[model samples]
Target: MVPISRLTVIAATVVLIDQWSKQYIQGHMLPGMSIPVLDGIFHITYVLNPGAAFGILENQRMLFIAIALVMLGLTAYFLKHIPEPFRLMRLGLSLLAGGAIGNVIDRVQTGHVVDFFDFRIWPVFNVADIAIVTGVGCVIYTLVFSTFPTGNQENQR
Candidate 1:
């Protein structure tokens, strides 16, 4: 189906971009090195995260791997249920799956996820993190606005 194709394409694209960006960063920057892209605002800082977001549960590589696998499975299951017209949902699911797989690969191979894109305020993150967060935001927006029959509208219907 078109939806499945679209989902696959999106997922593959995200994975490719995420992996490539991480590879580039690893190859160019030394760990703990920081290169300012926009002084006082943005920078690329190399960091190897041994845990989940914000570096929580550090060194729990196995746990993160298990969680990523579970997330990928759930994303696939969720995609199967999303209707064709709900393109945003498909995109969201794809991003989520791709991001999960990206990080999983790092965790499996290196026992750490490569992170950059330092903003100084928030914890440093990478392409996979961006995709995952953006995907979740899209899904949440779709659920809140498109899927739900809002109370007033429901009453009218």
Candidate 2:
């Protein structure tokens, strides 16, 4: 079983990073402000998203709220079923939960998500997106790379 204490630590870190980044952008960056950080390759642009990724279902605050709640619930349920040996995966999942909640809190409070990290080739996003993406990537990596060797491999070892 994963240690509850460790999971709490990971969750707290994710929440802090996500919330702090959003707050920093909201407070310091003017709405619609775009500052090119690396010529035409990277920029920091402030934006508020009222829906899901890429601003889907725009202005459907209630739908976003329900979706976030369902996601958080499903994640919590699956956390216990994840492989016991996959601590990294567990931590990653915890971060996902925390990050989702962080953004959900923002949406509930302001009816939008604060996004500011703008990539040249992609839609603008925030720290919560980074956490969620990284978390999912870790789970995928664990599934693909950490599977137990079978039959002949185990016998040979």
Candidate 3:
């Protein structure tokens, strides 16, 4: 069994870093301001996303908060149930929970998610979004590439 405490640390770390970065962006930049760190490649652009990607379903605060809470709750519950062998999956779930929390925190406080990272070609996002996407990718990789032992095999360890 992987202790929940260990995984909680990972989740908490993500939340802290994510929140800090968002705060930094909010403090140092104004909305729609873009500072090109690498010309034509990357930039730090401040934006308030009031909805999902590309501003879809705009201004749905309550719904977004409810969904985030549900997602966080589910990830926490799953983190407890998964066995130690599935470390990547657990990490992914932890990250997912953290990201969900970070974004939800912004929503609760400002009714918008604070975004900063920009790649010109893609919609601007933040640390929380990075964690969420990376977490999902990790989960998908684990599910596709890692095999779980059958029946009592886990107990035998």
Candidate 4:
């Protein structure tokens, strides 16, 4: 098991980065504003998501906030049991924890998650969104492939 202290550090760092960047973007990128970073592919656009990804359940800020809180609580409870030195799993947890709290901050302050990274082909997103997506992917990979000796590992005694 990796020390909980180290996990706390990682999670804290991710949350800081995620929250700081979101704040910066929110101040600079006005709602419905778009600044092209790479023509035809990427841009920075400010959007407020009151729902989950892809704008699902729009205007359900309370529900989204509740869900994020539950996710963070569960991740915190499960942190100790998660196998250590497992880079992917660590990263996944960091992402999940950081992203959840980051958005929670938004819900408390703005009643929505501030999103700014806009791709022409997809929904606008921010650092928190990136963390969540990548973290979820890492988790799925760990579950499907790595044999870490956690409860999820069937072979673990």
- Best TM-score goes to which candidate? 3
Superposition error at 147 for model 4 (Å): 2.7
Ranking by lDDT: 3, 1, 2, 4
TM-score of each: 0.90, 0.86, 0.92, 0.87
Model 2 pairs in collision: none
Tell me the spans in candidate 4 whose CA falls farther than 4 Å from its real position. 148-157
Report the C-alpha lDDT of model 4 over 1-157, residue by residue, as the tens digit.
Answer: 7777877777787789988888888777678888899987998888878878788888887888888888888888877677665768777887888878888888888888888888889988877778888889988998889764446556654
Q: What is the lDDT of candidate 3?
A: 0.91
The digit string of per-residue lDDT tens for model 2 on 37-156 reads 997888999998887787789999888788879988887888877767988788778878887888888988999999888887888888888888888888788878897645787678
Candidate 1: segments with Cα more than 4 A from true spot: 148-157
In model 1, the worst 10-residue window by lDDT is 146-155
lDDT of each: 0.88, 0.84, 0.91, 0.81
Indicate whether candidate 2 or candidate 3 has the larger TM-score: 3
Q: Write the per-residue lDDT of candidate 3 for residues 12-92, one digit (tens) a residue.
A: 898999999988887888899999999889999999999988889899999999999988888878888888889999989
Worst 10 residues of 4 by lDDT: 148-157
Error of 4 at 87 (Å): 4.0
Which candidate leads in lDDT? Answer: 3
lDDT of 1: 0.88
> Lowest summed-lDDT stretch of 10 residues in model 2?
148-157
